[model samples]
Target: MTEEPPIAVLTDDTAYAEAVQLAVDSAAAYYADGTSTLDDDAYDRLARGIQAYEEAHPEAVLATSPTGKVAGGAVVGDVPHTVPMLSLDNVFGAEQLADWATSLERRLGRPVAAWSVEPKLDGLAISARYRHGRLTQLVTRGDGTAGEDVSHAIGTIVGLPARLAEPVTIELRGEVLMTTEQFEVACLKRQAHDGTTFANPRSAAAGTLRAQDRPYVCELTFFGYGALPYPDDASEQAASLRELPHSEIMTWVAAQGVQTTAATPVAGIVAETLVQVQERIEQIATVRPELPFNIDGIVIKCDLAADQSQAGFGSRAPRWAIAYKLPATEKITKLIGVEWNTGRTGIIAPRAVLEPVELDGSIVTYATLHNASDIARRGLMLGDSVTVYKAGDVIPRVEAPVVHLRTGDERPIEIPQVCPSCGDGIDSSQERWRCVRGRSCRAIASITYATGRDQLDIEGLATSRIEQMLDAGLISDFADLFYLTREQVLGLERMGETSTNNLLAAIERTKAQPLSRVFCALGVRGTGRSMSRRIARHFGSMDAIRAADAEAIQAVEGIGPEKAPVVVAELVELAPLIDKLVAAGVTMTEPGWRPPAVPGIDVDPDAQTAPEAGGTSELPLAGMSVVVTGSMSGALEALTRNQMNELIERAGGKSSSSVSKKTSLLVAGENAGSKRAKAESLDVRIVGPEEFADLVGALL
Candidate 1:
């Protein structure tokens, strides 16, 4: 398991004191009014720093320190709680979790019989009191021991019904949160109401839950974690419910018309062993990005009532429960500027230049802004504080601008009127801005992609060399590469005699590449190297492919109704380039692929075998839907992902990019993170790269 960066320790007394004050202030603002300058991760780090400093010098500890207290002892409420809504201690990794579990067993004088694991939703913790099955009051977990009444938000919350299924008096403790969809709607509503947006879902939920007298209302969701007898109720049913195991209590809570984790993908699961508990934690982490609501960690608690009683409670939390913290996926950062870059297809995309912020273990200095319209929609501006979100290997995106944190110095983003790559007119007709020159404006990029190892496999034609050639007017499109003479290549700045010879030789070799590689080099909008391979193999010849209409193209394995037309249009648009390549003596037919039989044509049986003739069935990986992830090693180390997809197809397997129930196998190599976990959760067969290499050794 990969470990996250450790929290910074405050060695200086002055720095420690300042950190403590900052944490206290932030906590006070957050608990009092659901607003804070710092995000959860930033505050956690500051609190941990203060705690580390205090551990070394207890005498210097501030009285208002956030450590060892719920809500950091910053909030006071008029309404007192019958049972404290305590915070859970957190474990950053498996080792800490194991140590905590061992300590719990030691305290209990026995191994726990069962453990319940559930997502620790990133939301405001609250207790909802019901009398005779009717919701009476909603209280925020303001200092744990006491809370503020938020009954005004009772009717606006989903999953917490006004009346229960049965007439029972109970106090249900759970989290109040806004789902991703709800958060978006709330942001729109807030923007409409006052032109300000909440930073993230958690803060949005917090503000929405406590807000009153607003013209618009934002709905929130509740998920019950614990159920207990109401302070005024002495019913036998309520008493028995309190004595039941935590898992059963949650089930009972759900049965009584209150929502629990039962409906979500990361539902509360009962595990008998620590290993099982960790597995469940991994499973939840794998699906965390896909969950509608945000969860900061997984909560593991001893399931049995006896275990809970024996372990008892600590100063701030239960001894039997701990939160297995996942790495934070969001951070607030300053949008320094925006960069407009042209893609191969001439889509001018806007990228956010950010103040360096560590997110999900990476230093993210840049995030996707999407397009000009998205920038306007998000109301993003230079010098604005923006909430950047990232999950797993997905690219970071600027979710929204932190409107409240903006200064008057911030300026509106400048949308480019001309192509950034070339001084051409801009096509602002679609949501995505494009260069009027289209692919021609980004010729160098497209040519470089064409010479990539999986495409034309042209060696010695690095991006620098391609750019030099382009600037020298020796090549415009990739098709011009074959036309370059030895003298023409030698005219470039860095082209020595031997280097020129190698460059020319590399370009000459590309002329003999099969139709698949040549098609991949075309860089069609909807087709990648794998899709190009499928198209080339299905048609066998370039003429057959170009002659095929969109309906005919859809017969290929992965080509669909939407994508088929795009492929056809791209091919038609590239006709001049294709003719140039044909004229340059490039191979136009796939090496091993057999084209479909033509109707009413007398064919030579020995000339070419038809696809229906059982050629693929003999291959080792026939009929398999394979997904490859992470870095490969040994014999497969030199291969790019496109080459790997080529090998999978060569061995008669369909290569897929994502893992799902349909994924027949996963070739998970070193450091295969979420995909590997997801595959395990789905019970998909997995093999290491070396093992996979052996299976496809002949093809390799």
Candidate 2:
């Protein structure tokens, strides 16, 4: 066995200074390129090493060193900054933090007596400019000189205020981030769209904010760190600003309804020595794991404004402040192999099979590769050591492979040419490879969809049971599910006699499901429960629907010419399956179902859709599309929005979820928001909840 040579430690003062400068330049370049060469842990260690070198030989510290300036530079920023949003210098642990405190005292030539400590949030830095209490402009931190203008995108951020609590012109700097739950949802959506999933919450937040297309929906939030044009405290007269604390200023910011670390309950510690500050940092570290969002470290600032000013400013960061970064929740493990799984939508997603490593208190064995593009982007290869990190503490993601550690035996990842589950050809039209068989090949998903509440309404059929049935070959298609005898169901792994009886009863009950439901269960392209209802009403039966041509199908509202052919093709392909469903004694026609004048209503034309006895024979709401929003008040508080829609449908009307040009009527209630405004803009007729209830009462 050969031993690796020791890494040369820099002892020469000049050489140490040059090494620090090189590290800073590399970090800045990496930031500008939207990629990072160093992990958080490695960066912190580098930063600490630089600090140590400077402390050991104070005369050798360079004013223009990377350690003196902010780490990231924004060359692409368009909006000129009014006040530079400087980055903080980082320290790793308690010892480094103490050294930083001692350095600060030595620089100021005074004993540091107070500090304001807060979480160093792992997110994108943003400056929000407000004018007279109204949010005006928002920008990203671009090299502390100029920032990218993202005013158009600010409204999409969930926790950011559109209008201030008090109308005052001010510039507030904060970190923009998505909560772990939000990141998970965003990843799901991105993967569904064949887009790359973000590596972490911070990355996701940054990418979402910088997206050129404005008004995109995302659950991004902001937490104010500081504000420009500091608030005036006329009541107190201080000695050279020394008496004024930064904690108090932040308190004022929070009082104005701006979210800050105060909401996070970031403790303000007044420490005369470095030991006390270390204790405070340790306290924060112990509780950081339970926080809602990602926070990489703790930030300690000179509490007294006078002391902060006395310490002065660096080329890129404040001299009085330092960030104490926590140990990174990352690990390097061997990329043992890769496993492919098919999503319900037929997307073939890759999962990395890893040699188990403990990270952030959990043993992680697998991580999502997202897609082939992501795998390629990371240059992942089998039998190579890979870096893995958890995004939002929930999803494990493969960051990259350690190419330097790779042996010659490592193999390049090859995307599967066929679906791993069903052995069907892969559809490569999109970045995400999908199964050519689509929904049919996904037996569990097809059965689950068929038995959903809005479809065939088959009770006692859970997803696990569906998978079991498919595994046992008791069900090859949705129709085969109906033909499962009690004996066959009893043969399932977990099935008991009572469970089998319930399963048989549930399947038998589905035979009476209306033809519209059968159509929905068929899983035709460009068709759902509502579309199925429209088709059933238009053709009166399944046979008529099958016989209808594309032009005839196009007549249904929402089913246009392009979608009409898709519907026909899907139905034709399902002919044999449909025949089997008919043979299983499932309902082929809706006995008393009549076409509502408008689409999407499960209403009888005779106005008998609602439980109420009588209906207006005139059907005054016929052919009208109605939308309901907000909470109902007064007499109609007992009725839900769905009930109201049903009442409208029974009156020969259609109920829509969104207010569009097609919406002829809008039943608005208390606290109606954007929907009411949209309805008014579209010239939609507006009625109060009481009036709507009265109208329904009159019809009934």
Candidate 3:
């Protein structure tokens, strides 16, 4: 059997101390960004090694080591948590778990009778507070002290309640996650739209929850693990639930219409002894693969709250509970070669060509090496054996090379002298090399961006067909797409008569697309759908934008002076391409394009005589900041809070998630809770669903 090497090893005490803090800080930063730079498996292994070293040399342990607390930082700003959101310490195997139980019994001077075992969800931790049965504030667990307010995205999460079955004030602690099915669907959609796909369901969930736009596309879910009391209302429910067992608490929460993991067979099981708890953890690990969402481990907690209180806490984690982490799905493979590829942005990334090995139910042939700097840090060589694992159980990554397996025959990998894809000299100014040929080097990626839905809305122009056209020399650029002959397209493989006509018809329909879409399809630097819409509406026609100078272009909303030069340069570079597109009968002007005056920024001095502005007839809710609370009734009963916010935005107003003194109007619906009270306290104008309908109309 091949010896499994340690994930991380440090020789010097000073170096080890620095590594501990580095791991903590890096983990926190990555969590905040909704992405991971280090694999969890490697992180866990390194953490365990640090802990063992600390045990042997207690004086050498650094105060900033990640062992004693939750492994993240307060990067996302939000309100301070009333109760500290603690993290659970891990026990890797059954023996360690049993030892922890034994130690706990010794500390308490009694035999631990019962424990509750639940799956530890591999997802973003969130605290959702409901006031008077209405969901009010949703926040991420940032550094266990404070969190980012994500209440705006609450309605988009499935299995997360908008309102409770009974009127109560409670804080539900859970994991915001995405299921395997949802993740696959989201990846497909992202691939189609030319958006970045997440490494795993956890990253996907985190990104979706924090995303500012199109969060609904990622379909997130929440699984409740625990609950607490809202600061002011703690006496009411906290008193009544203080002595309840952990399993019973979850059951009660589930019964109150809050989704919980209680339905899982292994969860909520009362284990009478340390042996029983270990058995339950094993049972959970066995069924982990079949679970809808990913679970990293099993959490074993004291069943009774009274006992939990006596258990106390360490610097970070509670002593009453322990997490038994499942072994990581990993495999050892040979590093065969390195392949450098250029992206649409011209940045070159290195991929590790590996000897194929089966891992986590799939065949792994290659993994991402990140960049040349990363390569140097890992000290990777061509023929060295390396450990490979899925970073988040989704993305394949080269963890590190096994130094003991290295021989003199291993060759040192170096940065490429030229671009592999375009045969051009590499730009070495940055750590990551890029093709000096720029956008021209990645024509396929550029064309992919142009045909995306948010761009030209070209139907049936997916990546595969574009690659086929490109490989066959039928099209060189996006402008060439419009000039493709029917016979040329038919010459490509799998181009049936119906498919050919469909492609041709799709290409023809794009000519009449709105100028905003056309501008976006041109792939101008730093310009997206929203920016394109703003510019097109500001100028009314593409010709005016093309003829405008940097100063004039920067005058448009959102476009800054720094970006103005790039926008003008790109437009100038593509001026010939734009001419060809226009000559091909593509629409050059947006129909009925009007730049709406910004609220507060562009004040109309017409004596406030606008009809829809509580004066004259036109734009409804103009210059108003409206807050919608609770759930609406009648025709708009089914409309989600996000949808209602969208409706308010579309009607020329700002939609706020929280009520404040700045709020111009508060739309209070059924069971209006904390926000409504705040609105009333501030003397903000309050309106019913009917009144709100009168303002924005009942169109949605």
Candidate 4:
């Protein structure tokens, strides 16, 4: 009989005095009932580690695995987007990007005389659909085809209004991102407590919106990324009902309490308009974070109705629109030495050792030195200062520092530098400087990345942790986390039931993360998050991803020989690790992973009983967006916290999270935070919950 593929690998260990089951159960509890169980930092680190394991062993990966999907509560039903949301095909360098514009022009049978460049936000896309001047549905952009109902989630948003002034139905689409200010505060918190912090704003925003709590949702903001335009004759279905210009329509949309895309119209894609889009991207770093949402790149689209229709969609994206994403953030420092490092695929490259410095918030000790020419471009020598920051469209690079900073201690790192392992000679013909014995290089890129901010970000699992685990026969590969025993964990200094359980619990929570994070944690050379997504879309299943060969992987945009071999090699080496993880009981399935169904409004419980409740309670807030402030008694808390939700629904009104111009009224309690201050500045209407209840009683 043919042997079935190996499934179980990890055996219960004698090393642990107490069963790990409790910790595992706690992790399950945390993910299942969020708000309890694991803290946010623990959860994040665990999630990232599980992702790494899945990436390595695509075949053994679980369907319920967290790879390639966003997490959320069980959505009651799905709703179709009014306008089908189409995602963009990204390009890193400017040349490939210019090629996109040229192709668009060629496809349209014209020389694209001019183009607009706009920031492409790094966030989730959403749609807010309204009908007859009343607030309606809010949905997540699930899979570009359909979305999940998130109206309850919408109630907590800072900017969106509960009701509109005009009696017209419309759908608006936009992006959600965190601003620089939010990032700083969040980073500070993480650093302060030795917690896992967010790598960037876009991912953080996406994570925030997925929470079940409306209060959490209030922390996220949405901005128009794209819109559905009506026909010039106003004959399209939505347009005929509302007679307004597209630009004016956007303004009306804002009036209804949604942030629309930023724009300054000119006489048809003129110099002034083009400059505005460019200027916006350049100034994004200076924008106020408190304004709500985030933007990373700019998107330029044909403004005129006729012009947009003429420029249509191709296979993947629209011909009418183009995005100008910022290149990776970069910085420079002097190169101390050229060090050879083996990455996931074991290819060796020179990494520049440098004096520690800060980037964004994290300290940087090294930069990918790349090749001999890159080293020469900056002119390197012993004691010569160098620059370090992201490279083209990337964060920080090391061009040698200002010549003035060079000191005797500085030395030129020889391209074809000595092999890091044996101090033997190296080999190179300009393209890549490599150690002849590549695998022996002392530097380890993948291991370093396993602990890096964007990948695993596992707390207490620093370079030191890795070395300890390595020496203790605890791990040699990324998947080993699944096999850790509680007893073995507690044996480590400072590790106890609480910390041990916390770490393992983190592991359980992350078992079902999306595929993008998986790809990222793999640290495949030159294949970062965006490219990983494309690979995921094509492969779909982990088994298929693992089975695919280099040529197939290389077919994706920007996947060249340099990156392809690295991925293929890494995949091959990950087989044993995958087997061990599965044996050890790491979940390999994509639990609760459902793509968006056809768009249709689900029966919101509040909406279903809304009419009757509206008449019975909250007479004062009948059909009004209300915000609450300060500490209060239990009754007031109920009224402001959840009761307001029911009352607003019953009265045919909706409750909003923050106070803004669109806010109908504020229910003040005591000890109000920024919301109170912001409300005063905006001059929004405010009232006490007691007064609100009285108003409701009188109205009812």
User: Which runs in model 2 stand beyond 4 Å of their true positions?
Assistant: 1-34, 45-67, 74-78, 107-110, 214-216, 230-243, 265-276, 331-336, 339-387, 390-700
Cand. 2 TM to true fold: 0.48
Report every candidate's CA lDDT. Answer: 0.87, 0.73, 0.76, 0.52
**Can you write out model 1's per-residue Cα lDDT over 265-355, one digit (the tens) per residue?**
7889999999999888888888887788899999999999999999999999989899888888998889999999999988899899999
* Lowest lDDT 10-residue stretch of candidate 3: 607-616
lDDT of 4 by residue, 598-636 (tens): 478564444221333233233445547777667655345
TM-score of each: 0.84, 0.48, 0.49, 0.35
Q: Assess candidate 2 and give its lDDT.
A: 0.73
- Off-target runs (Cα >4 Å) in candidate 3 are 1-7, 53-63, 74-76, 214-216, 231-236, 330-700
**Which of 3 and 4 is the better model by lDDT?**
3
Q: Write the per-residue lDDT of candidate 2 for residues 1-700, one digit (tens) a residue.
A: 0111122256887678677766766565445432444555555556656766777788988765555655566246878787677888766556667678889999888887677777888888889888777888888887787877878676778656888777766778888889889888777666566444555566567667767653335678888877665244232322322255777767767776778876553444466556666656665565555567878778888988778879988888888999876656766678989999886546688999999876665689999888887787556789977778863356787866655456799998867888998998988876667788876667688778888877887888899888887888778788998777778888888889998898788889999987777888887866876667767756767887889899989998889978998789778878999999989889888544444456665654564233233333556677788898899888778766645655576566787877665788998888886577656544679999888777766543
Which pairs clash inside model 2? 74-143, 133-167, 133-168, 614-700
Enumerate residue pairs that collide in model 3.
Answer: 610-615, 610-616, 611-615, 611-616, 611-617
- Best prediction by TM-score: 1
Instruction: Give one digit per residue, the lDDT tens place, for model 3 in 1-700.
Output: 0112254666668768877876776577557654544456667667767777787778888877877766566365567888878788877666677678889988888977688888888888889998888999998888778878988787778888899987888889998888878887776676556433445566667777888876336688888998887556647467777678888888889988988886654455788877777666655655554467788878888898878988898877899998777755555678999998888757789999999876554688989888997787667889977778663245688866655456779999967889988889987876667788877799999889888866776888889999998888878778888898989988989898999999899999999887877898887877876577668767868878988999999998788988998899778878888988988889888654444467778655552223223321255866788888878987668776645764675566667766655899999998886566556545789999887887676344
Q: How accurate is candidate 1 locally (lDDT)?
A: 0.87
Runs with alpha carbons beyond 4 Å of true place in candidate 4: 1-77, 111-117, 180-199, 213-218, 229-237, 240-249, 261-294, 330-700
Best of the two (1, 4) by lDDT: 1
